[model samples]
Target: MTDMIERSNTPVRRRSPGDPPTVPNHPVGPGRLRVPLLMFGAVAVLVWIGIWIGNTQLTHDAFFPSRPGIAGGTWFEGWQRWDAYWYRTIVREGYVSYPGVQSSVAYWPSYPLLVRSVSWAFPSIFITGSMVTLACGAGAAVALRRWVGEFLPRSAAITTLALFLVYPFGYYLYGAVYADALFVAATIGAFLLVERDRPGWAGVVGIVATAARPAGMVVAVALLLRVIERRNLARAACSPDAAAPGPFARFDPRALRRRDTPVLLAFAGVGAWSTYLWVRFGDPLLFATVEENWGQGAGPATWFKVRVFEELRDKPLAAGTIGHVVQGLLLIGALALVPRIIRRFGWAYGLFTLGVVGLALVGTKDFQSGGRYLIGAFPCFAALAEPLVSRPPLRAVLLMLSLVALFAMAVAYGRGTYLA
Candidate 1:
């Protein structure tokens, strides 16, 4: 009985420096990139099916229709909808405020800027944009694998990546017009840099991330946590005694200066962009404030608006509200896993996920895009994946359900029925 308990409680071992990496507990050679790439291909197939269904079955009356210039109208127009159309407009016309319409100022400039430059050489801006997202999304998967492997074994790391690919709302990444794929790539790369103990590079990558989306600013919490953890580790190592160290041993002024500078620089990158927004639009936070036009605002009031009797009493039980409810529950579940992430990963990763989710929840009218927003909180995926690593049957069921929901969401999004 004692031996069985001990065996059951034993932790899985990771590959040593000399040992070759494996895939899903099998010897698959040192280069384990093929499975993840294959995973991406599978997701692409699902997305294509969803888009095809929408293009054939749905009416375009209320849909944000794409113009005939792209590929001479051979391509399906279902992929261009909601915020995607705004990105296209911004790329072509630049930011301009229109009466009653959401301000183009609300959209960050980085993605549209990239789209404009890439369009110079490509046949179609939409095609070029899709290529950009695919490339960045692939990079993000690679970086995410490395980060997850730091704590989990290679097999678990792969599972986590798989989970991310099939995550119910992951279809957003496939939308070429959405900047989320690039944002994810930069954000994951920044985290990977911190894991490698390269603070300066982390901050450099984090700057690009910060420009990708407003939620990018929350990464500052992760950087700060990394700085404090590193300082603590340095002080503990330098101490003469293991148990009780002197005051001098508890703090290191030199290490603080060396490590904390990069974090400040990263934050300054975000500040510089905000300053640019202020100069151009007269409101540094117009990006945030513009959410009001969409009925979103800061604090609990935004969420409470949906609950008021007079507000939603006449509102029908439509597809949009249902999608929001589904996504909100998913986001809450992910948020609830932060404590487990802290225990399994570390302070920086867990706190980063927590801070990002909390910030996203605030000033949001309804949870319409909560899933896509939470997709930026990558650690939540890791935390959710950890327990299912060894539970093949359970993981399989979860993946099946996720894939089903992904299909539904993809169809809805393509049909313009679920704009969020």
Candidate 2:
């Protein structure tokens, strides 16, 4: 379960003393890279097909009503929901608001800034956003495949990417207007670098990731914990007869000195954004506090009653009510698997996944965005997909559910529904 990289193409060559383990030795030849490239292409096609089908549907049953022609467009039509409009607004017009109060501060700046920076030459922000999102979605798949390949066989890694590509609510990542795709791409890339024993590069990628979404700050903790655990494991392996006190083993702090600097740099990503918010809005926590405006509170307890059971009690058969209840349950179910993930992968991965669930739990009304939030917790998906790797029938069943649900969710999203 806690296997390290050992691919045939990237054979684990013998290392000299005091040297960091080498990884990603797989050559970038056409024969080596073809599978991942094809996987990326396949994800793009599925995302495109979903958007195409969604464009033909009417927006009558949206989560919030939208006027005709407002959500329609030649490209990425109806993909712009409530939040997407705000992101576009931020990109087109810098963070200016009328009067004293504005909702624009609720969103972090990384994604809009990226859209503006990357699309400087393009006139249409929508086109730029869509292109960026699609590209990032493919990048995420490629990064995820590489990460999985570190532990699983090539065929298993490909199947894992395929599962993620069609994950029910995962289509949101491929949308032009949302930042989830970019966030996932950056996050997975950072972790993949960490797995390759490249913490400096991981930290660099993590900065962009943390700025993309507040939940992404957990990457720093993941890196820190991984470094500590890996060093301790190395020590234990080197000294099999070393005695430890009581039930716990001690880790040498000096072993982590080199790793800590880069991990701290990754953590600076959160601090940098907080500073930006404070300088711009006079409140570093403005983005977080704004969740109250959406009727969300800061804790798992806030979701247990009013967001779920109460809604069900008040409107037993209403679609929204049932949907909320189901999503809330799904959130709980995903979180329920964390212990297993930890036991299988190691404490670092377990703690990181726990942080993801914790972030998803707090600052929300319910598990409304649970599915989307869990997308950032890549380990959960990997753990879920682990057993099906060798079972063709089980994998097929999963594929069927994921594909059907993916198309259905994409249609819902296109119609401006709250799918996550």
Candidate 3:
């Protein structure tokens, strides 16, 4: 446990033979990248589907819609839910018109600001946000190619990026007037910066990301670690046998440690954000105010809005016990198994999964469709694909399918259809 925590906080250097690198309990550069390709392909198909369906849903009257203001849920219309409400509200009233809890616009200046800016130059939120995310998604793919050179080639990286762009979550998220699309791009871009050891730039990217979603705090934590490693580097630089003091003896072989700036920033971001939440809600760890507003302060975001009125509100958990811990726990289990699944995907990929799911576990476990909250962590796929799929041909196939799914999911999202 200590090792895991320390590993997470440390800024590790890119693998070098002399540096003695390690992968997820296995040899580095094992199988060729294949499985990731197919997964991405499937994702792509879903996205395309969402695009078609979402466009159609916009015109139908089967559902009523609310408008989301810049601050949160200040602009509630009768009957309609989240995504539709966001688009309508942003277009109709600008930032100040959000409804109830959803208005925590302070946490998301980037998306809202972008939408408003684009609205001035474009016709609709639908076009601007989608185009922005898609383009960012493409850039993320290119960055991913360079970042994952440890386990994948240019092709594998590109496939993973394409799949992430149209992921099922992107379909609904893109259509809705939210920051997810840009968030994905910023997060991935920051990770790529970390991979290159550009800590300051990475920090800025992380800051923008956090503003988009509280989960983005992970980037800040990773940055802090980088700051630490840079500051204490000299101590680590001490000669292996300088003094031979104790366990951390002046000269021991283990006295020195390599650094990765991004990992540290990710750690710091979470700490800072958590502290902020505490300050805002009079609690050290309160999440987005939106949950608190809906009275699901201690419930899952999904039906918790209803459940709080039915159960926990009067139970021991009371009004401030929010946490959709089940799925989050599952996401944790999946992350723990990540190293077992892939080679040396390391912090760039491994931690992305942990951070993404951890962020969702802490805050996103709410009134959202499956996979929506986790979409911003698109960087996780870039990292995870290396281990799950090997072999260029096989990885390509998987990515093709993931992209297809992305496309398909997009269509389904438009129609407000469900996937079995």
Selected candidate, larger TM-score, 2 vs 3: 2
Model 3: residues with Cα > 4 Å off, grouped in runs: 1-50, 53-61, 64-81, 87-107, 162-167, 170-176, 226-287, 299-337, 340-343, 347-352, 364-370, 387-397, 417-420
- TM-score versus the correct structure, for each prediction: 0.84, 0.86, 0.60
For residues 101-191, what per-residue lDDT tens digits would candidate 1 score against the true structure?
Answer: 5788788766787788888776666766666777777777777877677667766787888889888778777754688888888888887
Better of 1 and 3 by lDDT: 1
The sequence of per-residue lDDT tens digits that candidate 3 reaches over residues 86-183 is 64465556443133645543344556566666666655555555545544444444444444553455554555555455443455333344566566
Clashes of each: 2, 1, 125
* Model 3 poorest 10 in a row by lDDT: 71-80
RMSD of each: 6.5, 6.1, 10.9
lDDT of 2 by residue, 326-370 (tens): 666766777887876765556677778888877776656756777
The TM-score obtained by model 1 is 0.84
Best by TM-score: 2
Superposed by TM-score, candidate 2 places the C-alpha of residue 397 at a distance from the truth, in angstroms, of 0.8
